[model samples]
Target: LHCGTGKVSYVGGNSKSPALFISLLKRLKATYRRAKTITLIVDNYIIHKSRETERWLKENPKFRVIYQPVYSPRVNHVERLWQALHDTITRNHQCRS
Candidate 1:
């Protein structure tokens, strides 16, 4: 997802979520192909430290992860997006599988 100022992307779940991170890298590449480097702000999620992810990062020198401090939701701007999304979709909302 993207806020007006900058983009906010994420990968969730467990080790099975590598695909999400891969997709996010693709988006970052496409979105900032001409830029020198792309700075990514993220939480300290364990999957982010997986061997696969580490390998990908090792090869992709242009990409960097800036980890947010633990337990500090207020420092995460992406949480603002979640708050806004929640406020906008109040009541009668359901996730259909």
Candidate 2:
């Protein structure tokens, strides 16, 4: 869930945030028309293994979800993006809502 900085918060989540992840996917696919396969790298969360999600994955082989091992946030590029956003916000004192 990548979003431009604003009043709205775009959230990318780990296994702990299933609803947010699913919601982000819905938002992404709503207007997306490309036929290319989607490759996703994520942390291992229990929700990724949910029955419903698994069924969806089976039905959609074009979407690939790769789960990284635990305690490896440093390897996730989203962490760097968040850090950059934090730095930009803190430098301007405009992070708080």
Candidate 3:
């Protein structure tokens, strides 16, 4: 999510992997091409710190990742948004997909 414009950039996949996370970062970089830097607030998910991701980050110096406390979801606004999305759209729904 963009802090200034409230615009969200997201992509879904079967599972979380360093490749997937890197793809998301690429998408974000493309989305905000004009920005000098992109800072991501992320949890300590293994993929975020994986070798592949670290390699990519090393090549892309403009991107920064800040890890929040391991168990503190309240400090992340995106977590709250995700919770609301689950409550409204996914919880007890009958999609069966």
Candidate achieving higher TM-score, 1 or 3: 3
The lDDT values for all models are 0.70, 0.60, 0.87
Considering every candidate listed, which one attains the maximal TM-score? Answer: 3
Runs with alpha carbons beyond 4 Å of true place in candidate 1: 1-4, 7-16, 90-92
lDDT of 1: 0.70
Query: Global lDDT for candidate 3?
Result: 0.87
lDDT of 1 by residue, 1-97 (tens): 5445655654444445656676678677788799798777777776566677778888888987888864466898776777787788744686553
Over 4 Å off, model 3 = 93-97
**What TM-score goes with each of the models?**
0.71, 0.56, 0.87
- lDDT winner between 1 and 2, please give it: 1
Over 25-87, each residue of candidate 2 has an lDDT whose tens digit, in order, gives 555455343746656666666766677667767886777788887446567767666578678
Arranged by lDDT, best first: 3, 1, 2
Instruction: Report the error of model 2 at residue 8, Å.
Output: 12
Select the stronger candidate by TM-score from 2 and 3: 3
Which residue window of length 10 is worst by lDDT in model 2?
1-10
For model 3, residues 1-97, the per-residue Cα lDDT tens digits are 8888988788777778998999999999888899898999998989999999999999999998899875676787688888898999879996643
